[model samples]
Target: MTTPIHITHVIVGLDVGGAERFLLRLIDAHRGNPQYAHRVISLTGKGTLGPQLEAQGIAVTALGMQSLRDTPRTYIRLKRALQAHRPDVLQCWMYYADLLGGLAGRRLGIKRILWGIRNSHFESGGTRLKRAVRRSCAIASRHLPWRIVCVADSALEVHARAGYDRSRMEVIHNGYDPETFTYSDTGRHRLRRELGIPPDSLVIGSLGRYSAAKDHHSFVQAADAAMRQRRGLYFMLVGRDLTRENQALARQIAATPHPERFLLLGQRSDVIDCLSAMDVFCLHSRTEGFPNALGEAMCAARPCITTDVGDARQLLGQGGRVVPAGDVPALTQAMIHMADLDATQLQAMGARARGRIADHYTMNHAVDRFESLYQTAMALPY
Candidate 1:
């Protein structure tokens, strides 16, 4: 019998973001599969998801690098971890990890390396330091890893244009586990009650961290516009730093006619239940790789309205509406349009959304692809 391939994943941190959540799901898919074994290393502080991974018997290590100043220490620790494990494949997530991990893997004579790219665009906001780092990574992408697995086709294209090796790039869309994110009437009722939302009220929801790339301001503006056109509409915003304490978000809410109608639940562990409570899911991201929230909402049988970022339009296809990114007017119109749909039409749209996810983007399908890739990588001569 062939021995199980040990794969080490190096990531920036295990925060509760899309990439972090997706990594946990990927690790879960490999459990009990004798063909593969996994280990994780976090370059910064261990976040909430590390414990969950440890509970599953996966080893997770934190290098405890607080900032750029700690890069030398992080590299030393990562190299030692790699030398100890001597994994069959070293998989790096995000840019910083890819750069550091790839260098370490090469230094240790690891033959097969894979880099995961999770964002379509780098909106550096004119930070010279960030731009310099991105450029350095782009230059390294030309020769470092055996394969670059992009979570979206858009991400591949964007990076290719930015000088990454097109031949080495592979698109692997983020996967959704239907069993975990399925709709629940009870959950819907419970979340609505907890949030003080009327059972019959129309709810439009957006899930993403409060970042410039997420462009929550656009979502807030769209929600405001939609609420102006219709009464009894509620908006749900979920993610870290999305509370009333956020000055920018608070100002946006205060601009709305019915600030009381907005339900800013901030960050919650019950994401599935929160998704179930929504009448419509919205993604107004200015940039994305592949949106986990959009897929989760689809799996929860909620129709979505998303911007034309990453592979969102392809993911939605005919199942949901797509608008131009950062377009407040278009997003507002889409929100209003979805709000006006009759119960039957909305149900039909949601069914299509759910069907699309189940047919094309299940966790099993993603795991199969990943396993095949791993096998191929393992077969290559060291």
Candidate 2:
């Protein structure tokens, strides 16, 4: 019998962000498949998602790396782990992992090195160390990796212009599981009651961490404006650092006309149920790659409103609304328009949104692409 092709995934961490969540979904999709075997190595300690991966029967290793000073020690540990596994492929997620994993894999004479890029915008707001690592990755891209996988076409284009090896890059979008992210009236009402929101209120929800890139400030500003015009409107926000303890976010909510109408849910594990509770979902990020939240919400049969960032316009298509990033007026108008939409129209739009996900963005389709890519890489001459 032929041995299963072992693939080791290297990531910066296992936190509940887009790339990490997608990594879990990608690996979990392969459970019980005889064609591939997978393991994960986190440069930092196992984050929140580490135990979940272990529960799924995948092994996870954390190197406990905290700063640039740990590079030498981390490199030795990573090399030792790779030697133990002797994987056929090294799949590195994000910039840091790409550089570290690529160098380590090459040192061990591993030929099938695949680097994953998930960020579309890099000109604004990143640490100096992160910036330096990205620059280094660009220089090493020419020969270190056999292929580069980008989450969106926008990301591929952005990286290519930044001196990455354009010839080796390909785009593979993130996919959602319909079984996990589908619409549920029971979930909708349950979450509403839990948050002290009226059952009949029209909820406009957005999910993202509190950062300049997410532009929660603009989301709140627009929600505040729209709430003044519509009496039965509420906003539900879910993400890390979004609670009342976040003084800046709290102050923004307080300045709004009806602070009571804003519900802040910080870092939830029940994201699918949260998506089900929304009447309309919004993605207000100033920049993104593919936006897992918008697609997940659409999979839950919710009409969406998104800023023109990343591949959002392509993902949203005609299922919902699109406005310029950081345009408070445009976002406010879009919110008001969505609220003004009748139930039948809203339902029709939602059905279309869900249909799009089923047709083009299912987890099975994504997994098939990844498997095919792996097979192609394996067949290449070392």
Task: State each model's CA lDDT, in order.
Answer: 0.90, 0.91
**Best model number under lDDT:** 2
Show where candidate 1 strays beyond 4 Å: 122-126
Model 1, 61-102: lDDT tens digits are 999999888999999999999999889989999988999999
Task: Provide C-alpha RMSD values for all models, in order.
Answer: 1.3, 1.2
Clashes of each: 0, 0
What TM-score do all the candidates reach, one by one?
0.97, 0.98
| Residues 261-362, model 2: lDDT tens digits | 888999998887898888999999999999998999899989999999989999888889999999999999999999999989999998888899998999
- Cα misplacement distance, residue 266 of candidate 1 (Å): 1.6
Distance from true position, residue 31, model 2, in Å? 0.7
